[model samples]
Target chain A: MTGWLGSLRERAARITPGTLLVRGAAFVFAAGALLVAFPGEILLWPGAAVALVACGAAPALAPRTRLTTMVLFLAVGGWIVATTTYAEPVTWARLATLACLLYLVHTTAALAAVVPYDTVVAPAVLVRWLARTAVVLALTVGFAVASVVGVRVVSGQAYLVAAVAGVLLVAALAGLLTLSRRS
Target chain B: MADGSLGGAGDEDGWVPTRAFGRAILVVGVLVLLAALTGRYDLVVLAAPFALGTALSLRRRPAALPAPELSTMDARIVEGDDFAVRVSVANPDPVALDLVLVRLWLPRWVRVRDADHPYAAPVAAGSVAEIDLSGTALRWGRHDVGPLSLHGVACDGLLVSLRVECEPLPIKAYPATDPFRADEAMPRAAGLVGQHHSRKPGEGGELAGVREFSPGDRLRRIDWRVTLRTRRVHVVSTLSDRDAEVVLLLDVLHEAGESGGTGGAASVLDTTVRAAAGIAEHYLHRGDRVAMLEYGFRARRLRPATGRRQYLTVLEWLLDAKPAGGADQPSTGAFGAHLLSANALVIVLTPLLDQRSAAMVAGLARSGRFVVAVDTLPPSLRPPTDGAWGPLADRVWRMSRENVIGLLREHGVPVVGWAGAGSLDHVLRDVTRLASAPKVGRR
Candidate 1:
C-alpha cells in the first residue's frame, strides 16, 4: 500500500499543468454526459460545473488557494442539500451529487500526493473536510439505492432505511478509493 | 546589528498561516454543519474522506528550512594535494529529522573527482559528518568551498531546507621548475677573481706575462722599473687569482608599457629573469663565487656560494618572486649595499623604467665593481617621438637609464644593452668582450 502511494506521488509530480487541465475537462464532460442521459436532473448541472471549475483551478493555485476553494465548495454543497431537504429526493439529483463528490475525492487525493508532506502544518483540517463530505455523499446514495432494492423485496416503507444504507455504502467506497490513492 | 533582529523574528512572532490550510478548515467545518443540519448523509460521507486527507496533509512541514553551517578543517593545500573536510549539521529543532541531503560546493579550478568513502548518505542530528574529501588543488588563489545546502525531510513528509555559507579555504599555488634546466647549469670552481684558481697572471695578483712597460702604468707595479726598464717598455703583468664574488642584481618591477608582442615576444619580467638566471648559471659554471641580490620593495640578498645546490636555490627564488607595487622608482642603495664586496661582476637586469634604480646602478659603478647593466627594456615599451607627456615620460625614463650607463662607462664599467632576441650567450659574449677591454682614464 505504501509503495502504491509512493508511485502515485511520483506520478502526481510528473503531472504538468496541461495534464491537469485535460483531466478536469474529462471529468466535466463525463458529468455532462451523465446529466444528459437523465434530462430530468437539472440540479446536477450546477454541481458538475462547480466540480469542473474546482478541479481545473487546482493546478494553478498554491496549497493555500486550494484550501479557500474547498471551503467555498463545502458551503455551496451544504446550501444545496439543505434547500432540497423538504422536496422529494430525485434519483438524478442523488447521482449528480455523487458525481460532484467523486470529483472532489479525486482532486483532493491528487493534491495530497503532490504536495510536499512537510509543507502541510494542519492535515487534520483537510482530512476532516474530506471525511465529512464522503460520509454525507455515501449515506445519501445508500438511502436512494436501498429504497429501490427494498421495494422489490418487501414493497413497504422499510425501503427508505435500506436506500439510506445503500447510499452510505457507495459513499464509503468512493472515500476508500480516494484515501487509498492518496496513501 | 540588533541582537533580536538577526535573521528576523521566530515563526510564532512572524507566522503567516498558509491560505490552503485555512480554507480547508473553513470548508470542512461548514460542510459538517450543513450535513448535521440537513441530514444529507452523502454530503457528510464525501466530507469524511477529504477530512482524512487534510489530516494527512497537515502532517507535512513547511519547505522554508534553514541551511547548515559548514567549515573546513584545513584551509590551505598544495596543488595535486588532498585534504579532509569535517562537515557538521545542526538541527536546532527538538525533533529529529529522517533524511538530510547535503551538497558541498567547490571551486571550478579544483577537480574533485571523488570524495572519500560514501559521498552521499544520511547525516545524524547535531553531530558532525566527518566525510573525508579528497581532491587535487589544480590551480592557485582563494577558492570558495561551499554554501552548503541541507534538505531535511521527516518520515511524515514534512521538509525543512536550509542553506549556509561555509568557511572558505585558501590554497597557494607555487611555480614548478623544470629539472632539465637545472641540470644544464652546473657550477664549477676555477676562475680568476672567483673562489677558484685562475690560469691568467697579471698585476692584479696571479702571474701573467712580463710585457714591456706601457706609459701611465702604476708605479707600484713597476718591479723597480724592471731593471732600468730593460731599455724597453717591459712590465710585470700579475693577475689576481683571488676569488671574485659576482652578485646578479635583478629588478622585478613591472611598468605599464607596450611589450613587443611579435615573433619571439617576451614580457619585461620574463626577459629579466632569463637574463639573470642565464648569467648566474654561466658565471657559476666558470668556478666564480656567484650570488643574487634582488632589488624590489626591499632588497633580498643571497650570499655568495659556489655549487649546484646554490644555483638551484637561486633559480627557485627567482621563479617565486613576483613584481610588487606600482610604477615607483626602483631602489638603488639596496642593490649598492649588496654589491659592496663584489669584485667579479655586478650584473643589473632591469627594464630601466625609472630613475632611482638607474641612479643606484650608477652609484655601484662608481664604487669600482665590474658593473654590467643588461637592459631588458624592449623598444615596444618605449614611448613614441611625439612631444606629448606620455612620450616625454618614456624619453625621460630612457635618458635616466642612459645616464646610468654613461656614468658606469665613465668609471670603466661595462654596460651591455641586450636588445637582441637570441640566447643569453650573445649578451654574455658582449659583456665579456667589453670587460676584457683596457680601462682608459676618464677624460
Candidate 2:
C-alpha cells in the first residue's frame, strides 16, 4: 500500500509543477470575482483580493504549499458565493470588471505554470503572452457585454439560450482539459 | 537534462499546451453554468474572454515546422581572429511564428564576442529570421562550433514545436608562429637544380675563379677582362647554386610538462611542433626539398618536396602529432640512411628525454649526413615538486641530459638548443666546414 501510494505521489509530481495550483487558483479567483461583482457584496471584496494575491504569489512557493493555499482559497471563495443570495441584479460595469478580474486570475496561473522560479523569462515570451492576453480579454469583454444586453432586452428567453451556451462551454472546457492533459 | 539533450545536433519534436487556455476554459465553463442555472447574466460576461481565447486557439491548426539552416562566416580562422556564425529560420507556411528560441553549443576554446547566443526572435511566414553569433578563436587546432538547437511557439503560446538540433560545424585553426628565415649555408647542395651556392665549380652566376680556358669550356664563359690581361683566354668558373634536401626527424616518444594552451608556457610537444614548423618554413623558403619523419611513436613520413604549398602540407601533418608508442627501439626499420639523400641535412628535433635517440642521431652523422639535433625541452619547466629534493632531482636530471648531449657532440653530431633565428647559425657553419674537409672512406 505504501509503495502504491509512493508511486501515485511520483506520478502526480511528474505533472508540471504549479499546474494544478494555477488551475485551482483560477477557479477560486473567478468565484471570488463573481461574489464581488454582485450587488451589496462589499464585504466579499477582501476575499476576491486575497484570491488574486494568492494566485499571483503561487509561483514562488513550494508545490505542496501552493496546492494547500489554492485549495483553502477556493473553499473560502465557495463560502463567499454560497452565503450571498441569488436575487442581486448585475450591472454592465460590474460584469465587465468581473470578466477582467477572471481573465487576470487565469493569466496569472497560466504564466506561472510555464515558467519556473529559476528561469529568466525571455522578452519574446513575455511579449507573446501579453499579445495573447489582450486578444483573449477583448473577446471575453465583447461577449460578456452582448450577453448582458441580451439578458436585459430579452428577459424570458435569455435563460434558455444561456443554459444552452453554458452546456456548450462546459463541453469545450472539458475537451480542452483533456487535450492539454494528453499533450 | 534539457540542456544536455539540446547539445546534440539534430531535430526533435515536442508539444506543450499553454495551461492558460485550459485553466481559462475550465474555470469559465463552470462559472457560466452556475450563472445560467441561477439566472445570473453577469457570469456569462465573465466567461466570455476565456471562451473566446479557447475558441480562437482551437480554431487554427498549429503552424508548420520552421526549418532553419546554420552557417559560419569562415570555415577556417587563424588564432586570435573572430568567427561569425549565423542561424537562419525559414517559415514554410503563410502564418507567422510569434516567438522562437535558439541555443548553440560552443566548444571550450571559443568565446563569443557579444554573448548573443540563446536568442529569441519572431519569424513571419515565407520570411527568414536570422541571428548572428560572433566569437573569437582562443587556441590553435580544429574546434567544432555547434549543433544548433531551436524551440518555436505559435502566437497564442498554446503550442510549442519540437526542439530541432542541427549538425556541428568544424573550424580549423592553424597555429600562429613567428617568421623564421635561415641565413646559414646548407651543409651540402644535393639537388641538381635550384638555389644555394655549392662548393663544386660549375656553370652558374657567381664567379668562383678565372683559369686558362680548357678545351671543353664554352667560349661565352671566357672572362673578357682576365683573358685580355693574360693574352691567353681565361674561363670563369662559378659555384653551382643547387637545391639541398632537408629531412626533419621529429621525436615524439615522450611529452613532458603541462600544455597551458597558447596563453601559458608550452609543453614539450608544443615546443617540438612549433620549432619543426619554423625550421621547415625556413628551408622551404630557400627552395630546398623538405621532408619530415615523426619517430618515437608510429613512424609517419612525408616525402621530400619543394614548393610554397608544401609548407601547408607539412604544418597539417605536424599538427596531428600525438605522443604514442616508443620511437626509441628502432623496431620500424624505416629510419635508414636511404631515407636521407646523399649530403642531405638531417635535423632531429627532440626533447632529448630519450637517451636512445641520441645514439640514433649520432649514427646518421657518422654515415656522412650532416645531422643537427635540436633540443626542444621547454626552458621554463618547473620541478616535479616544490620540496628541496625536487630541485636536487631536477638538477641531477639536467646534468645527465647534458652528458647525453656531450656524447652526441663527441660523435660529430652537433646538438643545439632551439632559441629562435640564429640558434642554428654557429652549428651550421661548423657542419659546412666539416663537410669541406677531406674524409676517409668507411672501411
Candidate 3:
C-alpha cells in the first residue's frame, strides 16, 4: 500500500503546471454542483459529498478512461435521486447554476484527455482553449434563457412545442454533418 | 530555423471525432430524455451546452494537414558542446489549430535537453509555431536531431489531424581531444623548416662536438679556445632544425568495453579517436606535418599538412572512426606500405585485441619505419559474468593481450598505454636514440 502511494505521488509530480490548473478547476466545478443540488437537505449530504469527491478525483487520475464517465453518471444520477426523494421547490437560479456546473465538468475533462500530463504547454494554448469554451457556453445558455422567457410569455402548450422544435433542429443538423462527411 | 509548406496534395487527411464527442453526445441525449420524462424544462437547459459545444466545435473541419520541419542551428561542435534543434509546425487551414503536439526523435549521442517531453502549442490560422530545444552533444559522431512528428487538434478536442513527419537534419560532432603535450623531438625530421632539432649537420642553435675545420665549414662556428689549445682549426657543428612528418595509424580491428562519453570510461574506439586528436593537435601546433590513416576494412587517409586547418580536418575524419576489420579477415589491401614516408614517425593507435593488429605493427617495424604503438584498450574493462566460467575467460583474455604487447616490444616496436601528456615522450626518445646508433651490416 505504501509503495503504491509512493508510485502515485511520483506520477502526480510529473503533471505540468497548465494541466494541473485545468484539473483543479474541474474539481471545483464538480464539487460546486453537488453543494447546490442539496442546499437544505442535511440528511442526504454524506452520500452527495462522496459522489462529489469521486467526480473531482476521476478526471485528475485518468481523464481519458471510461471510469471518469461512470463517475459522472453516478454524480448526475445521485442528483436526480435526491431531487425526486425530497419535495423541494425548484427555482430558475438554482437550475441555471446546476446547468453551468455540469457543462464545466464536461469541457474540462475533454481538454485534460487530449493534453498529456508531462507535455510542455504554452499559456496561450490553455487561454485560447478556455476562451472558446466560454464562447460556446455563452451562446447556448443565453439562447436557452431567451427561449424560456419567450415561451413563458406565450402559452404552456407553446413552451412544450418550442422544446420539441429545438430537439428536432439539433437532430437535423447532426444528420447534415454525417451526410456532408463524404463531400 | 526550419520552415516548410503545409498541407501537401499527396498527404492523406485523417480527421475523426474523439471520445469526448461521444461522451458529450451521450450526456446530452440522456439529459434530454430525462427532461421529457420528468416534465421539467430545467433538465433540457442543463443539456444545452453539451449539445451546442459539440455542434460548434465540429461545425467546420480542417481542409488540409499541417506541415512540420526540423533543423539544427549549430554548424560544427565538439563532443560535450551545446547544440540547438528547432521544430517548426505550420497550420495551413483556415481553422485555427487548438493544439499542435510536437515530438523529436533524438539520437543517443546527441542530447537535446527537455526533448524527451512532447510540446503542445496553439497555431493561429495560416501561422507557424516553433519549438526550440537546446542540449549538449555528449559524444562524437554524426547524429540526427529530428524527424519532428506533428499532430493537431482543431475546433476544441472534436477534430484531430493526421500525424505529419519531417526529414531529419544531420549534425557532425567532433571528438573532444584530451590535454596532451610532448617535449621529446621526433626520431627523424624530414622537412627543411620546423620546431624539431634534427641530427643532420647544418646551421642551427644546438651544438654538436667541435670538429676539425673542413672546407665547407663556416668561420662563425670556429671554437677559438679549442683551436688555440690544440694548434688546430676546429668548428662547432650544429644540427639542423627541420620539420618531422607524423603518421597517426588507427587500427580499427577490434573494440572492447563501453563508451561513457567524455570524462568517463572509454571504449577502444573512443580512446583511439581522442588520443589521435590530442597527439595531432600537439604536434600540429608545434609546426609538424601531421597525417592520418586508417588500417581497417577501408583505408581512409588524410594527407600530411602543417596548420590549424589540418587539425580541424583530423577531428572531422576521426568522427567516422569505428571498429571494422575482422579478426580473421583483416584487410590491409588499401593501406600500402609505399604510402608511408621513409623518415616519418608512424604512431599506431591500437587495442591489440586481434592477432592481425600485432602482426601489422611488427610489419611496420620490419619495413624500417620508426613506429610507436599506443595501446587504446581501457585497462578497467571487464568481461560479462553470465555463468560459471566467466572469470576464467576474462583472465585468459588479459594474459594473451599482455603476451602480444611483450612480443611487439621484443620486435623493436615500443608499445605504451595512452596517458595524455608526455604519452609518447619515452617512446620517441628511445626511437631517436636507435636512429642515431650505427648500423651493423651482415658480412
Best by TM-score: 3
lDDT of 1 by residue, B362-433 (tens): 777666555667777765554566765877787686677677667766755556666433333443454555
In terms of DockQ, the best-performing candidate is 3
- Residue A165, candidate 3: how far off, in angstroms? 5.2
**Candidate 2 backbone collisions, by pair:** A140-B48, A140-B49, A144-B45, B10-B165, B14-B162, B296-B327
The DockQ-based CAPRI class assigned to model 2 is incorrect
RMSD values for the candidates in order, in angstroms, are: 14.8, 8.0, 4.8
- Score candidate 2 by TM-score against the native: 0.76
lDDT for each of the candidates? 0.49, 0.68, 0.78
lDDT of 2 by residue, A107-156 (tens): 54444433333222345555666677778777676776777777767865
iRMS, all models: 12.1, 5.3, 6.0
Minimal lDDT window, size 10, model 1 chain B: B178-187
Docking class of 3: acceptable
| Sort by lDDT, top down from the best | 3, 2, 1
Report how far off residue B208 is in candidate 2 (Å).
3.3
* Per-residue accuracy of model 1 over A6-114 as CA lDDT, tens digit each: 9989757655443354335434533443332233344456676455455434433432234325434643443354336434343535544644544353344333322
Instruction: Please write out the lDDT profile of model 3 over residues B104-207, one tens digit for every residue.
Output: 88888877777877788998899888878887888889887777787787767766666678888888888889778988878888877778778787877778
Q: For residues B1-70, write the lDDT of model 2, one tens digit per residue.
A: 1211212222233444443444544556566867678755555555666676666655543446777787
